[model samples]
Target chain A: MRDDVPLAATAAGGTRGDEECCTLATGPLDAADAQRLSEAFKALSDPTRLRLLAHVADQGCASVCACDLTELMGISQPTVSHHMKKLVEAGLVTREQRGRWAHYSVVPAAFAELRAFLDLR
Target chain B: MRDDVPLAATAAGGTRGDEECCTLATGPLDAADAQRLSEAFKALSDPTRLRLLAHVADQGCASVCACDLTELMGISQPTVSHHMKKLVEAGLVTREQRGRWAHYSVVPAAFAELRAFLDLR
Candidate 1:
């Protein structure tokens, strides 16, 4: 998603402070924000990706290497890497390089934001 | 989306009690469960659907009628009805017919399940 468009613009223009009050309700969502959020959810639409996220969360503070993921997912190394990259881009997981292996961990804030987005009456 | 296949199957089958501990990380997800969950996310992938959910939620405990949704969404009556049917099928919203009008409200439990599904870390 492009970062050029600001989220505050699409919000009902009353006052700058009032933007927070005009949530997903009140009116139509900003096209850019909706597209961005949809992309995140699309990335999560896959079961493999969901499993990967769960793996990282279950590890607590520890991270899982690419090699570890390959066996766990029953997928090829490149496939695992691709999924990891998608997760990283979606901000659902963070990757750190440790020598030759890439270690991945869950990003709690990203998940929290997604949860907040899903909140309904 | 079929409810027949149990979630406990693909989980590492050490014991029935161990199923609860498996979570999404321990092993590959059951194909049926993944498909069902994917369909739910697919139903929610649309911006219009998200807006509908948000509107119902913003109304607090009150429900919105089909006529109200058509005005708010600027969509045709049939289109709104179709979206409402899909939302009801996904369990994201519940519908109650008030005479000729159908009043729809958010199903908090369904949204909660979705939020829980998105829990990464």
Candidate 2:
């Protein structure tokens, strides 16, 4: 994915029409939005997930497969997949299927929005 | 508090020596650190808490009292106090007592750290 592209767009595989880009303080977030955002944060709250995020981010812009994550996290494939699912669903990570493997990377805009949400002033 | 002050520093109320400011990507966060950070996010996960956070953040740099939150959230005084306690304990908000009132403000450094934690790259 192009680094210059918006996070939601990158997550959608360069398809910008599918998602909207907004900051947390742009306006009031509804309960559902807050709940959804909270779930993403909750998923990241775990040490395993935090490590998983660190691994993926450290890999440069490249995405790694679930197999690699399983080995790194010392967890089963299913468990890694579950965490990946949560990360992907939360827009924290993006998954792309290439041949027999799926690659994951961090979504910048999602991170930006979350960062803005935590903006104290 | 001065707007230019760092978050942890501001939370410490001009006592910068008491806190250290750092980002999530700077290094590995241990389990206890993750646990503590998660608790803060968990405190922010609730709708009422989110609203409270929003209210406090929206008030510029000024801190709000528990009495104001109880009315805004439509929650009881004890419940608001409890939520305030959680927020303060988590380090997401700072508490100051003036006479019989307890004023709370968002801690910027805490928000910055959390925002960094959410950073995908």
Candidate 3:
């Protein structure tokens, strides 16, 4: 996953304000970058969604069945589907539909992008 | 700042499920840690808050005056105050009042803790 990603470009979305939002690299998170990142974090703001992320990451980012996620969360199937949609929209997790079920996993580059700005030694 | 922090203790509140919420170290983000992290990220979930963080950080963790933030954001003083209050509650930023105005700075360890979990390459 790391090999496929050009780290700099991933964080800085070229013409977008990605270059500016570097918490450590440049200045403050630029407007464009802030807009993008805020959406990602906003999706993560909910407790249920965080739990879903935890479950997926726990399975080693393996494609966890959406049905199992609904069971673990004890939320309605529609509610789980809603949370998954948000995560997918945020680009934090990927969804793969196997027949009637959807599988979820973390997007490493997305997590890495968030982690990098906070990495000031 | 880091030396004072017992990283384990910080991440895992003894009574809380901090140990269980390990996105990398353990299986899932336990309920307690998820609650905590979700709040922190929730504080960051807004564009205005993200901008405030960026502005404060751009100053090299130096204390930023509330007045300056108000002007920079082009928002009402009350709105800026509200956002800063949320950041403080989330433990992402520190608030220091010098006379009538408040000064803000980043909480390094807080950011570090968030980074650690996402450190899995």
The candidate that achieves the highest TM-score relative to the unseen native structure: 3
Instruction: Provide the overall lDDT of each model, using Cα atoms, as 2-decimal numbers.
Output: 0.63, 0.63, 0.70
lDDT, candidate 1, equals 0.63
Query: What is the per-residue lDDT of model 2 for residues B24-121, given as tens digits with 9 covering 90 to 100?
Result: 36345566776767777777767666767776666545566666766666788888888788788888777877677677766666777787666543
Error of 1 at A88 (Å): 2.2
Which 10 successive residues of model 2 chain B have the least lDDT summed? B10-19
Worst 10 residues of 1 chain B by lDDT: B10-19
Candidate ordering by DockQ (highest first): 3, 1, 2
lDDT of 2 at A56: 69
Model 3 clash number: 3
> Which of the predicted structures, 2 or 3, would earn the higher TM-score when compared with the native?
3
Model 1 Cα RMSD, 1 decimal: 12.3
- Residue B31, candidate 2: how far off, in angstroms? 3.9
lDDT of 3 by residue, B1-121 (tens): 2235332322212332333232454457778888888898898888888888877766543567777787777888799899999999999878877677787766767887677655543
**Per-residue lDDT for A1-121 in model 3, tens only?**
1234322322212332323332454456778988888898898888778888877766543456777777777788788889999999999888877677777766767887877666543
User: Of 1 and 2, which scores higher on DockQ?
Assistant: 1
Q: Over the stretch B46-78, how does candidate 1's per-residue lDDT look in tens digits?
A: 767666666665654556677777776788889
* DockQ score of each predicted structure, in the order shown: 0.13, 0.11, 0.21
Task: Give the residue spans of candidate 2 off by over 4 A.
Answer: A1-32, A98-100, B1-33, B98-100
